[model samples]
Target: MNLPSLRATERFANQMILDACRGAKRVHIVDYGILYGDQWPSLIKALSERAEGPPLLKITGIDFPSLVNLEKTGNRLVDYAKSCGMHLEFHSIATAAWESAQPRYHLFSELLFVNCQLRMRHIREDGIIDSPRKLFLEKILSFKPVMFFQSVVHADIGSPFFIHRFDGAWRSFLARLESFEETMKLELIDQSQLDFMDKFIEKCAMGAIACDGQNRVERISSYKTWDRLARKGQFGQLPVSKRALEMVMSVWSGHENFTYGMDENWLLLGWKDVVLNALSVWEPIEKLPRFKHQ
Candidate 1:
């Protein structure tokens, strides 16, 4: 099933990334939580079809060490780029924590973009000087990417109290399940596929409720919280372009239950009344010196 919110996020993100890299000779993308590398194939195709010819592309995918085989993911992306006749390089960084992962900065030249999708919340947000999320954001800012795009599930499911967290998770899960059910009803789906989706959602619900302390993975925060965090980190929010907004609207044009809107500079996607996800773009607050790779 094509999840409307996910598809909309991908479409909006790719459009922005393409626009940022237009006319650049070399482009580097640092992707956080690049599971399966599903978002890059369409981007590679778009680059290949560029009128001025595709730029040399380099992607550095960062994720937990045990979560995925980085080498395999890199190979798959490399092979896909080759098929498109685009020169590409893929680097994989596997670390226990995002704050500790150090990417090769010397390789970045010309255009640099960072893509963080539904993953930052996984970094422990304990109120401490060594907060992983803060350090991670600082690291990204240090890279001085032209544009930093973040898509996060906006839910108050990361509260410290179990009862509050459980209540938030339950409500968010129900909303997501309802949206999935409505979508499935519109599309002709077989029982086997239905069973698979059921399992998938159930697993996510269990993870959100039963786990805690480093073990709990789905630590989602509200968009307001993210907004404060980004501003506190000395990043300036960028407005979503008119074309990008229209493109996202077209993705959900036929789905009456789906809704889209903007909160400040962030673009939001929702199912009915419950806001599910948010996409925000940012750049460094102070201009930094640009260095090309030697």
Candidate 2:
């Protein structure tokens, strides 16, 4: 998909990953929902051109077993890495649930990075005592990655209440439609492309409004809710790096409607007033020692 917001978010994330892996000899990246592995080629190219040479890169792609062809994706990446003359290892973990793949992640001494882009919201948030969302976050935290990067759409459509969810989903659907319209006006979008965008937005709207319980796949939450969840899971937010900011701006130089800003530590990318996506970096907080009670 050539959506401006999606492209912008991916670019921003690639920059952050490149910056984070600056001096590492061996780097391991765990990518959630690594659909077609589109984000890595640029990072691979940059890493290969590094002054000290590219690190021994290992990427573990996790996704639903039925949704992706892991072997095909890995082969493509391996071929691309070979073309760049960079040594790379690709691992694939296919599972129905995110937390279930925890034991399968092959951790090594490499500096670790976890990338979750528009994927976490799909994990059900219904369980009061032990929600899947919380378990997934805890699993990521357990990895103790050097950097954890995530990008999510900022909306309140995840609410369980039908009325509230409908309101949020309606507004979100409109904002996305408006963005596409505005983008088409500024740039030349073909009829087919426009139709595809419409279908994508429609799917999301239907999922949010039509489906209920586990059936609702498009469960989006606000950035604030994500922040609370991350903190509760003992993760500390990191400020957006200046280099990442510059890279995003440079990519978006010509587009006036697409804007980027920082909300505390988050890097917010929006179309006009409606924030479409929010990207943030996080790290596991160290456990404090407890003195014996006297």
**TM-score for candidate 2, residues paired by index:** 0.92
Residue runs of model 2 more than 4 Å from their true location after superposition:
103-108, 184-187, 287-294
lDDT (tens digit, per residue) of candidate 2 on 197-273: 88988998888778988788878899989999999999999888788887777756555777767889988877767
TM-score of each: 0.93, 0.92
**Pairs with backbone N, CA or C atoms under 3 Å apart (clashes), candidate 1:** none
lDDT of 1 by residue, 1-294 (tens): 466676777778889888877788888888899877888899999999999999988899998888899899999999999999988898989886887787775435558888888777777787678788888888888888888888888888767788887888777788888877777767766777777878887887777778877787767888888888888888899999877787788777656888878888989888888888898889989745544431
- At residue 23, candidate 2 shows an lDDT of 77
Clashing pairs in 2: none
